[model samples]
Target: MSNIRGFRIQHDSLTEKQRIFIDDFSKRYTEKTKKSKNYISSNRYHLCDWMNSLGFKLSLKEMLYPIISHSSEGAYFTDIDGNRYIDIAMGYGVCFHGHKPKFVYDAIKERLERGFELGPQTVESGEAAYLIHHLTGVDRVTFCGTGSEAVMFALRIARGFTRKKKIVIFANSFHGTFDGVLGKMAEDITIPVSPGTTEGMVEDLVVLEYGSDAALDYIRKNADGLAAVMAEPVQTRNPSLRPVEFLKEIRKLADEKGFLLIFDETVTGFRVHYGGIQKLFDIKADIVIYGKALGGGMPIAAVCGRDDVMKIVDGGYYSFGDETYPDPYVIFFAGTYYKHPLSIVATLASLKEIKRNGNHLQEYTNNLTSILVEKLNNLFKQKSVPIVVHSFSSFFRFITVDPYPFVSDPIELEILFLLMILKGVYTWERRICYLSTQHTIQDVEDIVKIVDESIDEMRSGGFSFTF
Candidate 1:
């Protein structure tokens, strides 16, 4: 296992445990050969079967298909039966380059022999940090294992730097599942999403509607004790809607009121444009939280910002302080997997891939948008399906507020979604498309065709169309 790329995989046979993983893989393959396989042998949310075995309910009905089990190699996805589906989710924009690009896989393989995390820095960490700082125009970075951790750190930095409390987040934008975030989440937040998050760890965080000017107005009168205003430049799950002047005004207000402005670019970072969301709009924030697209599908995250503000992360002064207020001001941020070598190596490889092919990828996304809209609109019209394909770059969400004659609404998009499943296309349960480099013009065409046919079939069955 250790001597991988430095040695080899073909000549190096697997150990008992890994051999078991492969053997179990073989058995699963055989079960796939039979049509009578159980729905899901494993799930993404709960790695262990303990939940189902102990009587918890399943969130989604779709079971694993060819069930290609793996977290990395260019992508982390579940493959149904024998047929391979190009994963557009790419770990939900984590795989910005593609599923397990060769460079990333090779980097991880090489690092295996170099030994893993040593509770210290490695050359790869510097390399990854250099890549991020160069692209984002930030002076320094602190690494962690997930987007939520990065956000958590950003809050600490904000409070420590400003000597204040309270974080301002946006409604409908996702940072990660954390207490600081759950207080104002679009998703269910009353119950703990994860085990460790307690109910009242952070109920003071505020969530404001993103497309509102009143938010800034409210902040003006209510800026006291506020530490940071964190937001996404563009909402990833719903890219069709842009905040326009509202975001710029937020930055202005944050500056005027002395609250740090943090942009959580977890979903829209490296992929939107190499320089990130700020580069596209000519606006800058006080602190930025980057994870998803930046890490290239690795388990790494970063909190980046101005040196003076970040310098407030002085250990004894803020995080581990004698002042003793549990003052969120004293909240120190640290993580075990901060700058893990494997993750850093993956991020470095992924960043290189993005820089090398930035223009081509942008063109690909632009062309894809054109093709999908042109073709899909016609199909939906012919079928009397009122669904509108709202797109931006490689991200899109097809939704219709109105109903069609014997057509599908948002609820009906679910049935329309099944057509996608049969056609070998997968979408988030939220009904948005997270595109990837693996998708081609043909994939777009195929999706349009399937959508048209599915809507027609549903309409024929007396379903009313919304458009």
Candidate 2:
């Protein structure tokens, strides 16, 4: 067996027999996965080889090889090895309408036939903007090609509108891959998650604990220099950690302190409701960033805000011909594919479908997720495992307990991930699972069964709580 130290398996407290059992189980699991993925094993090996040759260093846990996808429709996708799995990751929550919904696909197809690349504007662009405005009650909307770009623009808008240098963000609240917002917690300070962040990248950032008094106190003292208080309405990885009162307090402070309240709803927007958690909680934001399910799998994102704030990007008003405009400052927000015709069509189709069935879709998915969480918790209780299942809207997580705190170790999480994938269920590395409108109650029940069996197998293999 491979050294447990390399995998970071912290089972030094386990008995000799238990350690042997775990090692033996790991070997068996390796053999089983290899046998099951024999057909695509070579493909994965070659792909990994190529990646290595190109100087890509991927950890074992990050590698999702031997399970290449072929095609997908609705709630399930077939692998290259002819294996079908219920897709819980759903392209990291982009396939809320499921893989290739007929309406969205047809819209894309129609746009392609007419002409995908025209110029800056398309018929669907105006229509999509209108739909978004009608749904979220935002005065103006602008499109972008990716969530990261949309967020970057939102921050820029906030900075321009408020004319403040500092911005505040909470721990573990991912806005995007943007360098300014990619910081992680280190002791009490926030440091860049990626290495390329310059020395002063976080100089203007006020990183705070979510829902903490320290955050509120800092905002109180430094509100004058803060441009925005940006947050994810529901943190994608840790969804159940919603700070309802904290959000309301932030909104109140933003109103009184002259800072913009920006909600990064990339994952929560269309998945939770037509207007996202803002609608659900009746808390309004000055600017909202949306992506993920916005285009039903197409690459599209929107930055929507009040007319006064959004007008900063009005190049027409800032034209040199307008002599009356004294301060003709223009906040440039542009991309060649800013309003891609295909993306617009897909967004329109997705919005229409969501509007028509949103109530039932949200209710059914939430209920199913609740049920799955209950079943998994019951299994954990039966096994006396120090783990609990929790859900927020349509998302679920498996949280560890005792010595490990609320988070699972990377190795443990990867083992659970592999087990779920082997049992025909797909989830992300964070142990986060999403339920789509396409998933039926039966599908959720099947997921519960697989989870139970996987846990049982792990327990039998000497997996035990350290405390």
Candidate 3:
């Protein structure tokens, strides 16, 4: 095991006790869910077999077969084999109003009657943009197909407006899979986390320790060369780690030094509150990126910011003999389906619903999350397990008890995921779970009960970890 600044990189193979427990649990699960196993084996053969044939090992499949989903409604989904599971993952925080929500569906159905895809512009698109501007208080809004594209555009706008070459990002903060921002930094300062990063990519990135005084010092020193400081207020993978003070400080520095502060609220947008983390914290950002829940499960995302910074995408009419020609240096941002009718209608409907009932939904989910964390911690204490549950708003995760470390071990987290699935609860491998408006108080209680039972079973199987 190599401990890198409190992060344990465990390379040792699974212990004998762990192997025995896993084998026993697998056998029991297979016997109990025979139909599901058969369906998965017959239909989902390509995920593992095909990948292995291509010389790529699929580790997640080795642990558990993919649960072939048949249908989803509210906060639950049913597998093809007639098994139902409570969906706490919620499409990785996309289904805020839950699956097949009536408001979103009705809006989409209406648009479907008119048309699914039109030209580059639509009345609904303008309405959606106006709603986003109204809700976020941003002066302008631009649409894209996905969250990754939105982040990419936001970065381009930042660099274009500030005329700076470098961007500062915090360690463990996930903006997107974009090549420019995917680099990770090690604590040693010598080792690079993104050696495969394309040439010229490393030179433009500055990785800082999340919420450290040293990071603040670095920002103060290099703010002139930085185009923006991009971050997620609450990291999706590690929900326990929130740097509130650091964010406030970043805003102050951005204001003082004339650099942009960008908040990637892709996961925390409407789910945290009606506005976002900005509204929750009462701290504004120069640029904001929103996705996931904005489209109510449709493939849509938006980049909103001050008017001066957002005008980089404006291409004035030149071919039509307008007086103002388009600026050659302006950043180009467009897509074939930039604002599809379905996405726009869904977004508008989602916003209307949220505006009407956002407070009640936020309160319900927040209260449920609080109750869940308390109950899970109590269970962990009772079982003498070195695990803890932490939550921020509707997002929660299970972390090891060692001054707040994310569960980084694949095998350990996979085992827990399988156990939860066996007990009719689903979550991501990061041990992160989400709550939706579709979930009731009874549903929260059931989730807690299942988690408690799963931990007790693990204890009986001799599953223990030392911090």
Candidate 4:
């Protein structure tokens, strides 16, 4: 079993007990999700479940189709099979307030009843902008449709404001599906991460080791042509990594090098704290992009930054009384659905709720998640499981330990996710999970028990985990 390397489903490695478990599990899961499986298979041409595009294997055939959600409320969502699962996925961090939050839903419904009024500015846009500025301490705020759009516009604004072509991005940080931010480390050079993206698309991108002294030195040496340094304050892939000192040093360099420091806080913004990582780490960035929880599950995004930097969007803000015309170098920035009334209304409701509760809401949720993570980790340790739980605020992930001899194949870890689903805990593809404001102490206890039982079942099947 230790010789296995990748995600191959080696039938020979499975013991008799494991095979029995797999057969039963597959049959039950298939029967439960038969409708979803058939629907997805029939719509294969048009509907692409890209998240589970890891290829078809016998081991994963029954578990491939995502549980079709029939209804959701609070910390639980019901699948089409009428099964309710504790929703730790939490809409991929968009449901900090939980599924179907009343405040946001009411706001959207009210706005819908009144009017959409798409073209002209909505009544809620200013309030949303004001709330964001107040919450994040940014001098200006701009609206966008999604995280990717906000990221692309933020990069353009950085470049336009700084008049520099190159941007510094860190390794192991995801900035969205934007083509410009899709560069990966290739030996000593940075290259496009996807096939369609050419070398020219990533030429201006400088990818460096995240939280390393070498990366800081590189930035210092090449600061002349650098417009911005972008990063996810706490990487989602590894939330335990809190590079506080490293980020502070980067902030210093941004000050000295005349480059804008951009924080891609799409996931971390409101989830980590009311002010995001900037408040958590006490390091300010020139620009910050916010999304996910900003609109309370509504599709909305925002770019907030210093006034001088953001003024380029509207040509430096000239008033009628002031003799000055719109004089600053203007950059093209517009979207047909930039501030859709529903999105803006939802955002307003979310921001207002955050304002009313302040950091207490975040503190309670973070503390709750911390306790849950500790309970899970202690259970893992007591059982000699080769996995560690780490979290940044309410978001947490199960990280496998390195150099463990017992865990032969990655499929063993994959099975853990399936077990989680079967045991009534909805998790993500990468094992990342979130604790929403709606999650209770009882929910945490229930999750811990589920995990303990799941691990015990897997252990009985000779699925190895080294001490």
Best by TM-score: 4
Candidate 2 stretches with Cα past 4 Å from truth are 1-66, 118-120, 184-190, 315-327, 406-410, 465-467
Please give, for residues 278-329, the per-residue lDDT of candidate 3 as tens digits.
8888889999999998989888999998887887788422556566676666
Model 2 lDDT per residue over 1-467, tens place: 42211333233455665556556655554554553345445456555443222211123322333445779999999875566899988887888888989999999888888877757478788888988888878889999988999988998999998888788998778777788887766675666666678647776776788878888998999898899999887787677787888899989999998999999999888778787888988999999998988998899999998888888876332455565563456687778888888888999999888788756777777787788788888877877766777778888778877765664353444556677787889765445678887888889789878877776766665665434
Q: What 10-residue stretch in candidate 1 is worst by lDDT?
A: 1-10
> What TM-score would candidate 1 get against the native?
0.78
TM-score of each predicted structure versus truth: 0.78, 0.87, 0.88, 0.94
Cα shift from native, residue 456, model 2 (Å): 1.6
| Runs off by more than 4 Å, candidate 4 | 1-17, 52-58, 403-409
Question: Once model 4 is optimally superposed onto the true structure by TM-score, how far is the C-alpha of residue 78 displaced, in angstroms?
Answer: 0.7
Over 327-358, each residue of candidate 4 has an lDDT whose tens digit, in order, gives 55789988999899998999999999999998
Ranking by TM-score: 4, 3, 2, 1
Give the lowest summed-lDDT range of ten residues in model 4: 1-10
The better-scoring model by TM-score among 3 and 4 is: 4
Root-mean-square deviation of Cα positions for candidate 4 versus the true structure, in angstroms: 3.1
Instruction: Name the better of 1 and 2 by lDDT.
Output: 2
